[model samples]
Target: MFERLISYLDSVRARDPAPRSRWEILLYPGVLALGLHRVAHWLFEARLYFLARFVNHFSRALTAIDIHPGATIGKNFFIDHGFTVIGETAQIGDNVTIYQCVTLGGSNPTNGKGGKRHPTLMDNVIIGSGAQIIGPIVVGERARVGANAVVTEDVPAGATMIGLKARSTLVPAEDWLREFIPYGTPCDDPPCDEQGSPRRDCIEKLEAEITSMREEMALMKAMLAECAAPPTPVRIRKSAAKE
Candidate 1:
């Protein structure tokens, strides 16, 4: 418990630029909320349904972050702000970061009970502020979801999901870890085509353009060689001069 608390503080300090004191971090709403959620989850898993709900209610009243007791969350997790909603069927892996107003909820709002209604986020996933990941989808390891993205499908590992409709592009997870993404995810865009597809599409276009230019250059060189070549010898004029 002591080691985990220290790790939590260290993670927050590393990610957040603000000067932090032990007291401040200890009093942080996110920390309190996570701790409360832990106890609630234990109770829920032990089949203490009513007690688990009561503890969750108490936690939400204090922190304003609603994490369902049935949700399975792993270690070194940080919820950056209040009002974040983690659904009942949501499963979160270790070293995950979630910003304020993020929702991991079911896509079919009309029906509540089913198998795997909420999304499962793998280790090292970062979810930006206000992003909504709905349905039974899996966000792969080290994936970054940009702010306000509406993602319903699976996101690949080590990729960045950007834009309103959410487009995935490959990016190194190491590069993303060094900076404080803080869930305000932004990075250098890989070359993309008109449809926002990756550099693969652009590569074909560039190659076609290069081929056209090379053909034009070859034709110009042939014309130049023809012009530079000497005219056919005038044999009749030479013979007349000799005579």
Candidate 2:
């Protein structure tokens, strides 16, 4: 068990450079939350629902991270800087890293029945701060969900998702294969390029659309100007008698 704890701390250190030592990592709210969650989850599985909830509430108060007791988390799961929420049905895989204020949220079931409502994050998934991963979606392995992204659907493996209503961006091969990225966002000098991939950058797409709209607007204005220009005043030449 001590070995496992050390491994977990090492994993967090691998992702976050701020921690000077294992002791510092241990003091992190996320680390504390996960430790308390283990106790809560064990009680939950033992059918001690009240005790599980009590432990969960205590952890939340102490760490400011709320992880439902029933959530299933795999090995080396790390939450950076806490203030994150994991729903009851959320399933997390090994080596998954989630940043602050992220939510593994669920959908509203019209039938009022609960079953696998939250997200399933595959191994090596990185979710940036404030990302909202809603519904019973699967975030595939090695995928990166960028900060503030709103993801309501399944994410493909090795994809990088960003923006509201999260859209996939073309992740460079190097970034895709990289073991860890600070915030699941590439800091490329120029994020988008001419050679668009399966799903190009959302910002690039929006820029193109804006340019197209401007061109269309210009064309429409020109046509309207031509139409609205006063017709050459009818040369009502003075009648021959009135000259």
Candidate 3:
């Protein structure tokens, strides 16, 4: 058990450089919360429902992290900061890291039956701060959920998800090969298009519209010129003096 604790602290240290020592990491709210959660979960599994809830609430009060006792968590799971909520049906796998203010929220069932409503995060997944991964979606292995993303569907393995209603894009091979990415996103000082180029199709469509407008204006000018042309002088045949 002591070795396992050391291993967990080492894992956290590897991810976070701020911690000067394992002792400081031990003082982190996330670490304390996780430790309490183990007891809560154990009580929950033993069918000590009230005791489990009591422990859960106490842990939340102390750490500001809410993890339901019924949630299933695996080895070396790390919550980098507080204000994270894990729903009862959420299942987490090994080496998963979640930043502050993340939610593994559950879905409302119309059938009124309890089931797996929360998300399942596969091993090596990283969730950035303020990300909301709602419903029974599966976040595949090695996937990254960027900060402030709202995800409602299953994410593919090794994909990077960003933006609201989270859009999944495959990371470049070089970036993907890196073991860890801070904030689960690539740093862009100035945000650029994913392909690093302007949108040619939209530019072309605008140019085409401008050309059509110019053609219409030219046609209108020709029509107006014809209409404004002076009527050819009517040649009145000189009436032979009929008087």
Top candidate when judged by TM-score against the true structure: 2
C-alpha local distance difference test of each model: 0.83, 0.90, 0.90
List the pairs of residues colliding in candidate 2.
none
- Full-model lDDT, candidate 2: 0.90
Residues 100-161, model 3: lDDT tens digits: 99999999999999899999999999999999999999999889998999999999888888
Residue 89 error, candidate 1, Å: 1.3
In model 3, the clashing pairs are none
For each candidate, what TM-score against the reference?
0.73, 0.79, 0.78
> On a 0 to 100 scale, what is the lDDT of residue 166 in model 1?
88
Q: Which candidate, 1 or 3, has the higher lDDT?
A: 3
Clash numbers, per candidate: 0, 0, 0
